[model samples]
Target: MKLGDVAKLLGGRLEGDKNFEIEGVSSVENPKPKTLVFCSSKRDVERVKDIKQVALVVHTPVQDANCVVVEDVKYAMAMFLRIFYPEEHPSGVSEKAYIGEEVIIGEGVYIAPFTYIGNKVVIGNHVKIYPFSYIGDQCLIGDETVIFSGVHIYPRCVIGKRVRIHSGAVIGADGFGYYIGKEGITKLHHIGSVVIEDDVEIGANTTIDRALIDRTIIGRGTKIDNLVMIGHNCKIGENNIFVSQVGLAGSVKTGKNVVLAGQVGVADHVSIGDNVQVVAKSGVANDLEANGTYGANLPSIEWSRWKRIYLYLLKLPELFKKGS
Candidate 1:
């Protein structure tokens, strides 16, 4: 692709070398010849200023370099990646795949070898189920959804259109529910399913548990990162972002556009309001109001300093008693 064509496709302003040939896309850290690199910061521009062979997609033009200046560099880079590396999956069902009785498969579907589609399942158009994936009985997978290798969808779960569930994701697994009876601990059987709405991307190895009696819902456009654990009956709202290793206890509810950072833990029955942003490693124990940023975890410091602070905290009770 030419530099001018890329700028036109990205709706960016071309600064120099309209005829420069961009054969690939690369990062600013490792510039490659004839590749287009995106520089969103001044430091990134400075790092690649001396490199003459690569074209740049930047917020501002660099002197004497072929540049395509865009308002949002990351979005432009995403578009470039989509164009350059379009995903290609096998189209037809493999002979080795196991299709059970009464399965309704749509046109243009791809089922790889060793994949198992259980009885009475409805798969939508252009859906791709990779090798070793298990679609349980009566599950409904919507159009253009891609279930990667080793993904296991439990029975009767409803997945919506354009959803991308990465490798090793386990949907509709039994929630951790138990009761302490007079005899001993008795396990409560989960009877409900999971509903993942449209355009949601579930990362690798993430698990969403099945509800005890009702649906555990993941709303539209939510992006959950890897190793996330969403407990049963979690009503996650639309466009929410849950970062890697976030753990939500059962029956927690989050409003739309909420952002839970990496390793944040939400207790059971807590309700977070719309547009709330919780920082990394925070523990959310109570309800959070809408449109606020919250954090409770302390930042890392020197070990000696942390010990001094810990000592002060330990002595606070004695100091308070003496003051009283």
Candidate 2:
């Protein structure tokens, strides 16, 4: 692809040789000949100033190197990758893949070797189930969804169109619900299923448990990161971004555009409103209102307040000795 063509595709202005060829994409800090790099911020622009050979994706046209100026660098990167680095999948169902009786397999569906589809399963068109995946009985996989290698989908789970479940992801597993009875600990069986809507991506090794009664719903366009644990009955809204190692207790509800950073933990039954941003390692114990940035220590205080308190605490021992 040419540098000028990339600008046209991104709907951005170009300020470079239109005939310059671009072979690959890389970060702004590192440039190779014919490589395309991205400059999302002013700092990135400064970093790109020293480079001369690469094609650049920028928020504004600069005179440094060949540039494609767009409104959003990250969004443009995603779009460019879709064109240049399309995903690869095997074609057709393998003979070693097992399909149970009465299963409905759609046209162009790719079932790799060692995949097991249980009874009455309905797989949609162009769906790719990689090798060693186990799709349980009565499961419904929507069109263009990709279940990567070693993914385990328990019975009756409904995965929507364009959903991507990465390798080692386990869906519809029993929730961690138990009772201490007179005899011993009694395991409560999960009777519900998981409903993942369109365009959601579940990261590698992330486990979403089934509810005790109703459904565990992951809303449309939500992206969950690797090793995140979502408990039973959690209702996650659309376009939410959950970073790695974030844990949500059972029955937690989150509104749209919520951002939970890495290692954030939410307690049971907590309701987080729309556009709430929780910083990394924050512990949320209660319900949070909309349009706020929360972070630090216990109870998830406002981000600014948390920073102030944390700084004050660092001086506490000095103040105590001076008082003595």
True-structure Cα RMSD, model 2: 4.9
Q: After superposing candidate 2 on the true structure, give the runs of residues whose Cα lies further than 4 Å from its correct spot.
A: 298-324
**Residue lDDT tens for model 2, 72-129:** 9999999989988998887798999999999999989999999999999999999999
Off-target runs (Cα >4 Å) in candidate 1 are none
Clash count list over all predictions: 0, 0
Over the full model, what C-alpha lDDT does candidate 1 score relative to the true structure? 0.96
**Global CA lDDT of candidate 2, please?**
0.93
Writing each residue's lDDT as its tens digit, candidate 1 over 1-324 gives: 789999999999999989999888878888889999889899998887455889889998788888999999999989988887999887999999999999999999999999999999999999999999999999999999999999999999999999999999999999999999898999999999999999999999999999999999999999999999999999999999999999999999999999999999999999999999999999999999999999899899999999999999999999999999
Candidate 1: residue 21 Cα off by (Å): 1.2
The global C-alpha lDDT for each of the candidates, from Candidate 1 onward, is 0.96, 0.93
For model 1, the run of ten residues with the poorest summed lDDT: 45-54
TM-score winner: 1
